[model samples]
Target: MPVLDKFNMVSQGAAGNLCWACVGWSVARYYDNRAGVPPRWSTLCEYVMKAADFLDGISPESTRCCDGERLLDPDCNQSRILPDAFRVSSNQGSVRERALSFQEIKTEIDAGRPVGVEVESSSAGSRAIAIYGYDDSESQKVMVGDPAPDAPDGALIPYDELCFGYRHSDATWNHSYLTVP
Candidate 1:
């Protein structure tokens, strides 16, 4: 059930906003592990950003460093784009939900699915990260694949700290997460 080892953390770089880059990386990891087809993170990121631009008439540049609110919008939602991006059947769709509990996240990880989440960082503002595993031996922590340039792959972060930051963020979509089912 542990999937952290299956994933490779890819940095977002200047390709797009953290939101789209994380989405791209998460989705790419999902397919890479599930199908053994490795998709480029930059290609997936561009696909997502271009889809947003086409649907919402917003320039891709405007999407750079976007907050979660913009990401959750109907036109820009990853749930809406994932099917097309990967050409999956409509029934096997992605979901974006608010305030998912730690247990919910654990359940998904146990199922071997990586989750995309928006967490507020005090110094870095809001960014999206992919959750791949969890540890509850002592203090509960989740294994995260962050898309930040300097972030190492498979970093363990305290679950409580992530929850607190997500809950306290100003964005309405603060505690929201995306899952492909």
Candidate 2:
């Protein structure tokens, strides 16, 4: 058998949404194939977070948070989260991260980095976006910063019918993004 071109997700986890996981793996694969070196799941996840922080010159140690609660803790006061935060179990598949605002994830894409975040919508299913690039909103039209060339659904989903959760929409059906204002 031919070695699969993409990393096979040995197991799928029971979580809110996994599209983000696919997005994460997409970035991992890119580095694996193009960068000539890649980070492990744990390290790759961190690199993604660091890329996000590069915008503000923050370090992983400064932004690391195990969970949303910790990330929001006054003491931790973290601005970022780890893929581990989404991991339901070390034995199971990777967990997906929470949805962050567009502004929160802009820089990573601007720098050619991939980051995951949940996006809210009325549609059913878990959803995550791999932020790739952003269009100047000043143009009066929204443009996507699509990093994953093969994302299941075309990037730039508008809110309204978008709902997130691993099975919110059947994986196949979910790819048909419903756009709204």
Candidate 3:
């Protein structure tokens, strides 16, 4: 779970779920070779929310659904935002998304790239996690940065459990997986 040694992980604190997504973006940009100095967390979050059409520029610190546009937009400059890095192909929905497989997720981690995850939450509607490391063999666990104020930066979850929870059929979690570049 300690694989993310080089990522510039940030906590959302009281900023809310949207802020978590920004943390993911910031991590991605931090790894982008073209990016300059990392921007403030708020700046990254605001930019993402704006792209998602959240015009008010606010982090509600509460559960809410976000427009998927910002996270999935292939045209988005990965060097600047909390949006995910997905490999695009001609397919639909999860099928297209699955191109970045679990092994690829591990490869990204090995290469110092942080992964972005989207998980369902009953209280918060939708939530995001920044994945920095994974125990691929011994425990099959992942190290994640939870943006919630009460959660610590490096929390652990079973790799299979997290992946299973991500499925829409899972009662506790709806979606899970790292979108890699």
Candidate 4:
């Protein structure tokens, strides 16, 4: 009956029906609420991501401060108003290694399910994102991305390449845990 409940239901689905966008919005919402983590949704289409906006909206200060790449420090040294999840991992493998991996991402992909990518790499400009969907079965290249109209450019990357930036190979973000009360 609630958005979080709906998100939980969708997350529980067999891999093909995961609905990653909802998951992304929900998880980001959770982090924003619980840990004061900033929103990772596209700035270009902030209005469209209403739920995420509600969790962490863009403003002049938050904009320069909260960008996904910059939020990695839990202390948020750069940002005067620090977010909780920012420095939670600190170069360690993502907390996600307990579950979610290439094989798991593949299962979700084969089923047309959505997956969330929680990667943090200086090479990647230091940011985390929610992969909308992926095509891991492709022979040479696997496609992973979100469909948000205003997402950043150059979003897609080879599936094999996606795992390195993260702290864990098996971490998949779950949004139901992210609802804003």
Model 4 alpha-carbon drift over 4 Å, by segment = 1-23, 26-95, 110-112, 123-125, 136-140, 146-156, 165-181
- Model 4 TM-score (2 dp): 0.34
Total backbone collisions, model 3: 4
Cα displacement (angstroms), candidate 2, residue 181, comes to: 34
| Root-mean-square deviation (CA) per prediction | 7.5, 13.8, 9.3, 12.8
TM-scores of all candidate predictions against the true structure: 0.62, 0.35, 0.56, 0.34
Q: Which candidate is the best by TM-score?
A: 1
Q: What TM-score does prediction 2 earn?
A: 0.35
- Number of the predicted model whose lDDT against the real structure is largest: 1
lDDT scores in order: 0.57, 0.35, 0.50, 0.33
Model 1 Cα lDDT, one tens digit per residue, 119-149: 5556556666667888887877888777667
Candidate 2: segments with Cα more than 4 A from true spot: 1-20, 38-104, 121-123, 137-181
Cα misplacement distance, residue 79 of candidate 4 (Å): 8.5
- Deviation of model 1 at 47, angstroms: 3.6
Ranking by lDDT: 1, 3, 2, 4
lDDT of 1 at 139: 71
The whole-model C-alpha lDDT of candidate 1 against the native structure comes to: 0.57
User: Is candidate 2 or 4 superior in TM-score?
Assistant: 2
